[model samples]
Target: MNENKEYFVNEEDFIVSKTDVKGRITYCNQPFLKIVGATQEQLLHKPHNIIRHPDMPR
Candidate 1:
């Protein structure tokens, strides 16, 4: 193994909110709202599936 190489921490172990590989919010940390600047009410009904354009390859 390459001792000089670095490794990335797993998402669950880090504090970061990420979009899934398919670009959707699957799991969010406590700071999700502060990061996205949205309220629970704003995020409730708005999963990425809503605003997705038909042209998207997915």
Candidate 2:
């Protein structure tokens, strides 16, 4: 079963990412990878939405 979990970020924590014109991830910072629980190899070139929460509006 899938569970919905919320993650909190600190004020000093800054997540940065860059996506291509097609919304594919091209660049992401260390904080982004850590928060998303993904490695650079896994996230690069993948759709940015892959990490989006289901509750988020389109």
Score every model by TM-score: 0.33, 0.75
lDDT score of residue 57 within candidate 1 = 70
Candidate closest to the true structure, highest TM-score: 2
Shift of residue 50 alpha carbon in model 1, Å:
7.3
State the C-alpha lDDT per candidate: 0.56, 0.91
lDDT of 1: 0.56
User: Can you list the residue pairs that collide in candidate 2?
Assistant: none
What would the TM-score be for candidate 2 when compared with the true structure? 0.75
Give the poorly placed runs of model 2, Cα more than 4 Å off: 1-13
**What 10-residue stretch in candidate 2 is worst by lDDT?**
7-16
